[model samples]
Target: MVVLSKQTTEQYAYIRHCNKTSAFSSTGIIPVVDLSKPEAKTLIVKACEEFGFFKVINHGVPMEAISKLESEAINFFSLPNNQKEKAGPPNPFGYGNKKIGENGDVGWVEYLLLKNNQDYNSMRLSVFGQTTDKFRNVLNDYICAVRKMGCEILELMAEGLNIEEKNVFSKLLMDKESDSLFRLNHYPPCPEMALDNKNGENLVGFGEHTDPQIISLLRSNNTSGLQICLKDRSWVSVPPDYNSFFINVGDSLQVMTNGRFRSVRHRVLANGFDSRLSMIYFGGPPLSEKIAPLPCLMKENEESLYKEFTWFEYKKSAYASRLADNRLGHFEIFSAS
Candidate 1:
């Protein structure tokens, strides 16, 4: 079994990144909403415009579903090497990896990836399907549940733009297309591989980075590694608020809106103890879709915020950035390069 060190329970509660001084001055609040209500329209719009990230208290996704996904993930990681290997290696698209973060240069974590809106019975079965039927079905169910809720949030973003809900969803999650899918991230504990305190003492949690999709749903176990950059150069910790879901806009939204939205950079620090497992649902359009900036906001000499590119092209570029550090994924293409 992959073991994680034990820290006090007090350590896990929402932690502010207190620098030599205090790290939290800006009060980062995620707007809470009940998507069923008419009032949620304005509330969600305002939330995205102001916070880029927010939490939904009354989203209809069942409490049981979220719990099950987390449990199964832990269970998968717990299995003997043979069962997981059935899924195959971490292919070009990031399916299965036993070495944790060691890609070309593995970090100290391991992960499994699946796309959103993907189909299993078709010509392209998930890389992990070779491993076991139960694994594939369980992951499939989790993706559907998260996407259902993700769609609701996308519709709200459309309302924020005052465009028909279908417009935004089309750009982010093309109808009838099972775009990229679920990524299971596991941060196994690392205690000895420490960096010099001078450069920047080794982080106790995940280094900073942001999701590449429209919305990322994260679940934190007893450990913590989430941090967010403020409008200022400083960064703050994203407290593990189990009662709500953390939603952040991705680079696509930042481009589509022509700068009205921000895809802030965030990351995770290595925890002194406790393995952190998180599942991120990437909402993407089909590789066939053109990823050019939306004309809706591209009018003025408004600084063509991003160059026109296809989803396939964009993801290739993102993978390169992920190589440097998770934070690189948060930067604009030019900056990442």
Candidate 2:
């Protein structure tokens, strides 16, 4: 009835076509935590440092919201192709990107992007905003829950960094508007896998890449295809933990913090016989902050960790290059290196 930890939720989660056990062998493993505990603070920090990854059970957020978002997204996408395509991102970049039919630029997934702020950039794109009443209402409610989670995490991070919660919230994101997009990725069972071998690989959820922003708040259902890389360069899959969304610092955060936090390299593999769903909340700093490194990140050597580039420029280049093959480039121009 309640989604607590990966163990408890596994019993309740609709288990289907789970080769995730195989994924453990296909992809090893990482640490798991319960962030709400006072003791877990150090453990989680150490886990992130050592593994750049971990899982948590009973972290926060409601299971109801997670289920609602997943169910609604599936329902929206299942609509006749024409209707679903109508909601496709019109902007081409931000929200309303296109729905990939067979072989398109973005790999094997379709999405709906939403922004709570009045982004003139998003408006400039020909993409249609969430106009469907049913979809909009459901999405808005779902987003409210996620926003709360993001804010809570930011505050927790402030404590972890020994900074005031207000400082973190003010420095990071403010309200629902700043440029962020949620991608609800659905990887259909491979056609090739079904007809003949029914075991062949055809699904490609997402190619390898670090999130361009500061942090990615991620949650996946029982479907297993997500993997994170280790320092030794092995890929490990973190099976979705119930109620707790896994958090990975992104490239932006690495630069802002002068590499105190590392952005991980991760990829989505193709599923052979089942559909998969994952939701990503890409959160970043306030609009007022420069896209460049913060003074704090550079204080160690009095050297900035990145080239002096605006957020807009970097992301544009990233998208154009499918995220520069996922190896977040070095900040050399102004770096102490």
Candidate 3:
């Protein structure tokens, strides 16, 4: 069992735990889409509408790029605690541990958050030393491939919707000013959770929450910890496929579709022995972009279910709230009785 320091124990002690048996056993229920198929557009749309999440295969990203980045991330996380600390406390972009955000949400994870932009620089040269350039190159390669795949998926969604402008969704992400982000999370093995499972509770690696961006792409090692809440509110375990990427329709996408695509609420649990590593790319729009239901997607005289708000406003609101808070509730257009 991994022994936790007094501070570490206190940091995670107050976190909310869930029943380990709540996870659905059947993984076949999760949607799987092959991006190379001719029917991918329609399938992508269907998956988004139904699960707001799906596993994508043949997504055009090179396996070499994926493995290299994962290796680099592992090396960085393996560094001495002091060396890793030089990279951060994540002032919204660096390294973070246990604490999820400024809002007091804690988890059994440590992570590196980075802005996805042209000016992307290495996170503290001292952290990686001589391998900084290699790390940067690998990271850039991974981000480039993932961002392209994200744009492709969005265009496919527009095509499936039969929208006249196929680039309507993709263009936002392709924008140079897109407020995108990349994150690498490491959940170390916590055997203590198993010994303390008499109450049927498990440690939270990441709390349940919806992504706030337009879309998100996630790839993780072969670890069984991710769980997504279904429409009926039952949690289902997502079988890990390291070679494939999982796509999520984010809260922004949910609102832009006028609620057609519901954002999936998901969380992760700490494994008793195996560690879990995940990389996520959040594709966001430009800060100033006004988010609203596309006129083309709405029916005749259809009323918008949300008030128009800038991505900046929404993002600010999201960052200020707890992980499980309903970030969209403030932007909802309530009907007058």
Candidate 4:
């Protein structure tokens, strides 16, 4: 039972909890795509259309490597709170614990967030360099492998949309200088939730929000807590799978596709028992690349649903806004024609 800080408790008090529907099937109809098969593109297209999220197996990442990364994460996070805090407060990179934003909403989670670059500053390299070189090596390896898988998925997405393999969408992300972020999230058991609930609302490990990247790849330990919001605004719990990585379209992809694919809103619920860990890699284009609806996807007379914006600008604005606010709305353009 981890204790919440006084300020954090007050922050949580102001958050609006989602309607609990655990009675709803823990398993929603998320499509499963076998990356090694011939039907992979067709299946991925269908899943993107229907759910904008899917499970992928046979994605070419070795299971042992994944286990190693998970084990390393568990060991790092299991350190004493005082020791972990020495890694420093949350920024665009490094470790963060119970990070609360300007809106007074606290994320009941601790994470080691990293940029996918060797030269960038990292807690693993700066703090525990000599002792935890193995940890750093394993994490870097996992990031490279996962990033390769993400590019492969992007190619398939382009093929599905009948776009050229070298189109702007895929090319920008694959550029040598493209930016991506990884969050190794750990949500400890909040046993106090059972005794502390005054309104019978569920404990939110992370508040409901949509990812702003082009796409997101996630692998989690076998602990059930993640949930996705359907088009009907109802919540469906996402069950855990140790062997599969979950793929989700993000707000950038939605805009790139003219809303043909949605960036799903998802959240994590804390249970009174069992700790949970999830490794998420967020994919994005280079900071200078401007994203907007693809001209190829729109009819000649159709208006663009979203205005063009650079990832760098959007990211800075997003950090300043509430976590649950619709950041994409800021880039929307409306016309009466």
- TM-score top scorer: 3
In model 2, the runs with Cα more than 4 Å from the true position are 1-29, 93-106, 117-131, 164-166, 169-171, 175-177, 196-202, 286-288, 297-302, 324-327, 333-337
**Position 294, candidate 2: lDDT:** 56
Candidate numbers, best TM-score first, in rank order: 3, 4, 2, 1
Per-residue lDDT over 92-139 for candidate 2, one digit per residue giving the tens place of the 0 to 100 score: 533232233222344454555555543432342222245344455555
Q: For candidate 1, which ten residues in a row score worst on lDDT?
A: 6-15
Q: What lDDT score is found at residue 285 in candidate 1?
A: 70
TM-score of each: 0.76, 0.77, 0.94, 0.90
Query: In candidate 3, what are the lDDT values of residues 273-313, reduced to their tens digit?
Result: 78899999999999999999988899998999999999999
Please provide, for model 1 over 1-337, each residue's C-alpha lDDT reduced to its tens digit, 9 standing for 90 to 100: 3633332322221223356312333564546677778877678767666666666767776767767767767776776555555554655434354333343433445666654533442212332355445555666776677777888878777776777535566345646663656677777765443322234433433344555555666555655666667566466566665556667777666666765777667766664446787777777776656654667656676555566666667766676664335422333455334
Sorted on lDDT, best first, the list reads 3, 4, 1, 2
Give the best candidate by lDDT. 3
Q: Which residue pairs clash in candidate 3?
A: none
Per-residue lDDT tens digits for candidate 4, residues 267-323, read 887665678899998998888878889888887898888989998888888778877
* RMSD of every prediction: 6.1, 8.0, 2.4, 2.7
Model 1 vs. true fold: TM: 0.76
Number of clashes recorded per candidate: 29, 9, 0, 0
Q: How high is the CA lDDT of each candidate model?
A: 0.59, 0.58, 0.86, 0.78
Assess candidate 4 and give its lDDT.
0.78
lDDT of 3: 0.86
